[model samples]
Target: MDIHDHNRRAWDRAAAAGERWSAPVSPEVIAAARRGDWAIRLTPDRDVPREWFGDLAGARVLGLASGGGQQCPVLAAAGARVVSFDASEGQLARDREVAEREGLELELVRGDMADLGVFEDGGFDLVWHPVSNVFAPDVLPVWRECQRVLRPGGRLLAGFMSPAYYLFDFERAMATGECVAIHPAPYSDLHSLDAAAREKLVAAGELLEYGHSLEDQIGGQLRAGFRLEAFFDDHWSGGPEALDALMPTSHATLARKPEAAT
Candidate 1:
């Protein structure tokens, strides 16, 4: 099965089902953003530091894999020229819904995150990516594409699940709160789950996730020429309750492409 196409359909179902991430931001939120009182998250709970964005006024921002009308609209309200790119048409529709309602201008593009060839090289000043990379089977290409599209000294703000979060049997933990370590890092629902289990997930229209390691999540950015600047941890309120209380299951990072030599 094609992971990208399958995940796209899964996310479309998720949007239609009113998944929390699929919910669009309110007009009030956009109003606050215009008044310089806006905050957005890369992780689940913690707001990304405002300093990370500096003055968004006129900044060329790419909302990478970030549709569903959450971050991009707010950034646009904050004066950034924003483009939102995602694979799911439903997700992009939410962004458009908000854009139309709030009178915000947004460039919405739908495609695989790893293949950002639609965007020109050094075309953006910032890439705001939330915790959606888990849906991608490979992240190195995504990182490379992010680096390529960013101007020198541009920032890449990204969030992702902690590698260890996938070690447990999530189904068992959610039902019984028993965090049985059944999987390893770099896990994939396609290869990690048995045929019966995988079929059940697909039948239910659930997202097929990948557990990418730190080497691919963080180190991949460095390998792609981003310099790590700041980082933070956040917990998912919707995740297994036992594990959510134990430790942070996700992280956000601030990395920058090096300035060109004079």
Candidate 2:
């Protein structure tokens, strides 16, 4: 399966349906951000610490898979030269909508997160990635590409589902409020789900998610030459899953590319 193409269509449908993550931000949010009262999330509820961004004034930021018109517009309002990149046209359109609505400058690009070939090496000071990468089948390439696009000392602020979140039968847990361990880490909807279930998902236009292991999600950043800086755990806000109430199902990380050797 062409996961990129499939997920793009699914996300486009989700955007059209006004899914939570696909919805655009309000003008008030943009206005506030312009006044330097801006906050963006790498996870569900916890705002990414402002210090993680240093000073946004004139920072070159790539909103990698962050094209829901949420973070990119805020970053632009906060004085960053922002590029909103994603695979889904519907998702990118949300950012474009807000950009037009607020007269904010944002470069919108549609592309896979794992292959950031459109961007030049060391082009961005920060890559703001949220939880969308769960749609990608592999995450190591995503980390490597993020590392490749960031300049020395550039930061990567990312959020992802913990591998543990994939171990459960989420559908069952949501329906019965019981955490039933069924799958392993590094799970794939394509391979993990039964044929009938996969067909139902495809028919419903839902996202095909992947559960990457910590080795690929976090350790991959270290393997790609980024020095881990800060980490935090977060939970889904008002989530339906049983585990959402028991423990954190998501995580955020701050990493920085090493300074250039003299």
10 residues in a row with least lDDT, candidate 2? 237-246
Cα lDDT of model 2 by residue, 105-145, tens digit: 99999999999999999999999999988999889999999
Candidate 2 clashes: the total is: 0
Model 1 worst lDDT run, 10 consecutive residues? 177-186
In angstroms, how far off is 257's CA in candidate 2?
Answer: 0.2
TM-score, one value per model: 0.98, 0.97
Which digits, one per residue and each the tens of the lDDT, describe model 1 over residues 29-57? 99999999999999998999999997799
Model 2 lDDT, full chain set: 0.91
Q: lDDT of all predictions, in order shown?
A: 0.93, 0.91
